[model samples]
Target: MDPCTYKRYHKHDQDSRQYLDHYFSDKSQMVFGEDALIFPIKSLTNAFAAGHIKGDILLDISHGSLVHHLYSACEFFKHMIVLKIKDRCILELKRWTDKRTGAFHWGHAAKHHADIEGKSHQLEDKEVKVRSAMQHVVKCDLEKENMTKPIVLPPADCIISTLLLEAISKDQDDYIRYLRKFSRLLKPGGHFMLLGCLGETYYTVGRDKFHAFSYSDDFVRKALEGEGFIIDHCKLQKRTAVSDLTDYKAVIFIAAHNKK
Candidate 1:
């Protein structure tokens, strides 16, 4: 199914809301893995705090689940930019790729794709340039589209984006594009922070699931370097036996800006 439909299905109506409450409260395999968006931001906040991160400027990508956590974490920031892009762009959908090797792969996960189960899909792309400019690094027009070249951004003291890029990239190039899309965010003398699923795959809504792409730590590092984020610190965020779900951890990246 497309993202619009998936978003509709995920709407917190009274009935679906009831299911979420029960699902989150469950002490079994089902609930623990099901709830990812909520935990990553909380975990990321604590991780940044663990490093004693406090600054006067901040930027966040993917505004959905991370909104509350970011607002709470960056109280010192005089400016904060929250970004929301396609979780899975219906217009820019691409096939899955290998997490480590960046190779194309497909599977017959028929049990999951009840809707759009056998439909032809296209590769999706996000404007990494436009996205990079959105985070208060500089003043760029959000009203325009189809930019010819990337614009520059002001160096921020700290930047945070969560669970983005991984979901939008259908192939390695797309992943690189997603990373390059954010290249301009870090200015000289700036810092960076990102939290994403290390090997996250599959998205299920009320019993409907779909195949998803996840990136490895190596892939993430390469993409960051490709985008000008030189890695200064990296951490394995959390490994919880909180439930029986496969152990998926958030890889946190803290890089320093080297650009003049």
Candidate 2:
């Protein structure tokens, strides 16, 4: 299939519910439960616990309506501002934040988070903390000069973007450009944590196959360094589950700080 024919994430309509069901359903097996969900949660939890990433404001530019990753982050940050490219994603997340009747249940993911932290009894409190910390969910357009445009956001002390650049970028240059934009959102010396897939391409959401930019660990390091970020820690986990929903060789977590 020609690369151009592949659906561009920002340009096309995405089914937010289907995305949540396929990858984040409470019953999802190891493939997503382990690599996609647990891996990032553990990484974030450790990072926050070790005093590696923390601050007053955290900017989140993640894919879909998933909130599993934020369970750990809310403990470390006072406020969180989520930027989404799709209105559907914003609405889906709002449903959960507002405690609407049909919001997607993330109890399983929260339980795992609690289990890892040895606070299983505090599951309900964990969910409440995340919702309270997540103050704003604003729509953004990455294609523009300023992603948030008229609604200028304050420089965040930390930024956590998961599985978003790979899904939206068409090529390496585009990836770098987006990285540059992300860098601009951070204050000097602020931390940036990124979780994404390494290698492989094309992830299916519902019936549509969307493009995923393929790159390696070295490529990511160079990209971050080029954008004036100092790499602090990098962890790579080999893929353990077999499925056709998506093809990714490994999951990567990188923690870096913007250089002054």
Candidate 3:
């Protein structure tokens, strides 16, 4: 298929041009953490819920501030795990988990917190005193980085991540190394979906730079085969990320899982 231009919210529109304005336009404005857009994550999660793609544990480190991704877990998976690696992500999470429910959800970044009742991360509505105190809270030293370790995947029913692989090692060897890293994150026969910009130029948030890495499925397949993952499917979706009216090419990806 030849590359073509497209809109940014193509999934909302089967035609890839008509962007679904919102499920509920007025109600769309979330009161608490309106700064974060949870709609797309919600859309993807809803698709997972409607299907049989639930996993025992799910992790999305995309750094997207979409909070609805968490709610979808309530319907899709028997077990759900989430991690917020950034402060903005935490803010988005806290907004939806306000103490009004008399429950605190953030703890050790897992679903286990939901199972056993315990003290965990709490939501705040602008407690300057508390925020100030956290400044003085010292964090533990970083773990010793290891390289050249034999890469292996951990067993999980499924794994899904977006916009993360781009942040890992960039070259072919590093890309293969990342494939090996995720291999350790998935179960022997697990499934996963990686949705991203196959031809993205660049995007920066705060001080971070996310560059696009476009490769054919054949290229991806060759690399993953070496890492124990087989290419089960490949699709080029008409993503709603057209930078200009003339750009038809959107995001492309190779979705697969463990082979052996």
Candidate 4:
């Protein structure tokens, strides 16, 4: 596939519903349920529960309108500010957050969170916590020097971005450039958690193929190091699902703290 033929995420009209159904629906048998959903949920829950990441403010810059990863995080942070690049994604998230009539049902994801914490009975409460913690959803543009631009945000105690860098970046330079932008959002010594795929070139969503920047674990470590972040914990899960929706060799989770 030609690089120029790949659809640009920010410039295209993405079907948010199709994205949710393809990857996050309870009945769907896609690999995301195992690799993307379960892995991040378990990893984040464990990280938060162990007190590895705790703060008053958390800035989340994730791809799509997904909220499964924030279930565990809501409990640890007093406030969460989500930055989205697309209005469609923002609307999709608001549907769930505002509890609208046709909101996407994330009950299964909530249950998974509760099940892991052994609080199956409080499944309903889990979603409430996530909604409550998400205080703001702001629009962002990665190309801007200050992604959020005119609306300056307070430096966060921790910043978490899941599968967003690769989705938005067209190449390694773009990836590193965006990484620097993300790093600027955190305070000195603040933690940063990143979740992304390894060796992925493309992912399809609702009949549209989006480019994914391919990078290795070593490259990521060096990237963080170059940005003055101290590596703390890193985990890699080998791909186990058979699907044509995406071509990812593995999923990686890295937790680090900025030195500056």
Candidate 5:
């Protein structure tokens, strides 16, 4: 399925209760492994907090509304721009950042991130920081040459995406094409961080199923290298058990830099 249809299937916060509960809840660790979302969040937090990666602007390209992946890393950048495929997703994110009524509670994820940083008691503080760092939540069309058209954005120091390409690409070729489009939004030597589900073809948002690209570490490595990125980090975390919700074999996280 293309991004537009995929966007219709995708929901965030309250609308994505089923998706969040099935894939991101703490209980998922018993079936999907502890590192499903933990590894990427903690790793990015550690890297940025330690000065291993430095950046002034960070852009998050995600299918639905997802701020969990940006919580920790947002602290490292002065501005955070979120590019979403649908206006609904953008609105959901804006509700949270704008502190609107009935906003989905991200306290759980924020608390988890804070605990990882050895500040378990500062959940509220972390939430505030994440919200403050979220400077923009904009609409984007992935299939277009300029994803964020009409309003030009400065080249980002880092571009981060999670499970975005997998849900949008029809095959490896499409994945590469989308990857190159993302690269164009980054400055030279800028970092690209991605999280993907390995060997995944379909995932559920509510009652509907969405397509995801099936990929391996080798496929990903070759793709990034072929696009002129220098590999900085690569890791694959195997699943503990299989779930009917998805057919992913493992969770993969990669960090690479655009060649200067």
Candidate 6:
């Protein structure tokens, strides 16, 4: 799609709450339970728990308002910076952080984190911890030379992006460009934890179809390597649900570092 077409599609109505519910709610797990959602969540938990990834500051450049992948990593970071491409997504995330009415339920994700840590009874406490760790929410522009404009943030010790690059990028070149942009936010030797859909071509939000770049594991590795990153660990979970909502073949979890 051309720039105009992409912008038109993006500007179209997208019910963030409904979209979040469809993918993140407890019921949605029946569709993306193990491979798409659960595996990535558990992998992050284990990575932090095992000391594979730990840092004082974390930068999350997520596509949407979802935070299911963040529960387990909160305790490892003193401050967390969350960035989004759209104001609507930022507002949706703020609603949850500010404890406003009509916020999507995140208890299930918190509970899942608690269970992983063997503290299942303190679900509320876990939620509070995750919310408190999130210190800033800023807007990001991938097309810009600097992803975060106006507000310059401290270089992060770790960066996390979930299903963001492919969903917004028009193709491989765009994806590579965005990956390089993301790397600029990190300090030397800083970690990058990326969660993405493998081989996905499209996804729907509120009846509007959005383009997704179909990518393989090798492509991701090459992109990271080209950007001067050393791959540390990578895992792939094959798709289980055969649905029309998306055409993703697998879910990929990768942990890499800026080459020192």
Q: What lDDT does each candidate get?
A: 0.44, 0.90, 0.40, 0.89, 0.78, 0.82
RMSD after CA superposition, every candidate: 15.6, 1.3, 12.3, 1.2, 3.5, 2.4
Model 3 per-residue lDDT tens digits across residues 33-118: 11112323333444554465665455443433333334334444444444333444444444434533522232212222222213
- Taking all chains together, each candidate's TM-score versus the true structure is 0.53, 0.97, 0.52, 0.96, 0.89, 0.93
- lDDT by residue for model 5 (109-135), tens: 787788888898888888888888896
User: Taking the tens digit of each residue's C-alpha lDDT, what string does model 2 give over 1-260?
Assistant: 66567787888998998888888787635257788888988888888888768889999999999799899999889999999999999999999999999999989889989999999999999999999998699999987778888999999999999999999887899999999988899999999999999996888888888899999999999999999999988999999768899889999999999997
Overlapping backbone residue pairs in candidate 3 total: 15
Enumerate residue pairs that collide in model 2: none
Candidate 4 local Cα displacement, residue 191, angstroms: 0.7
Tens digits of lDDT, candidate 1, 131-223: 222343222222234211265334557767655555455557876865555645555656667666677554444454433356688887777
State the lDDT of candidate 6 residue by residue for 106-202, as single tens digits.
Answer: 8877777788779988888888988899858888776777777788889899999998888777778988988988898899999999999999887
Q: Pick the candidate with the highest lDDT.
A: 2
Model 2 weakest 10-residue run by lDDT: 24-33
TM-score, structure 1 vs. true: 0.53
How many clashing residue pairs, candidate 5? 0
Q: Candidate 5's error at 248, in angstroms? A: 0.3
Clashes of each: 5, 0, 15, 0, 0, 0
Query: Cα lDDT of model 5 overall?
Result: 0.78
Task: In candidate 4, list every pair of residues with a backbone clash.
Answer: none
Off by over 4 Å in 3: 1-52, 67-74, 99-155, 206-210, 244-249
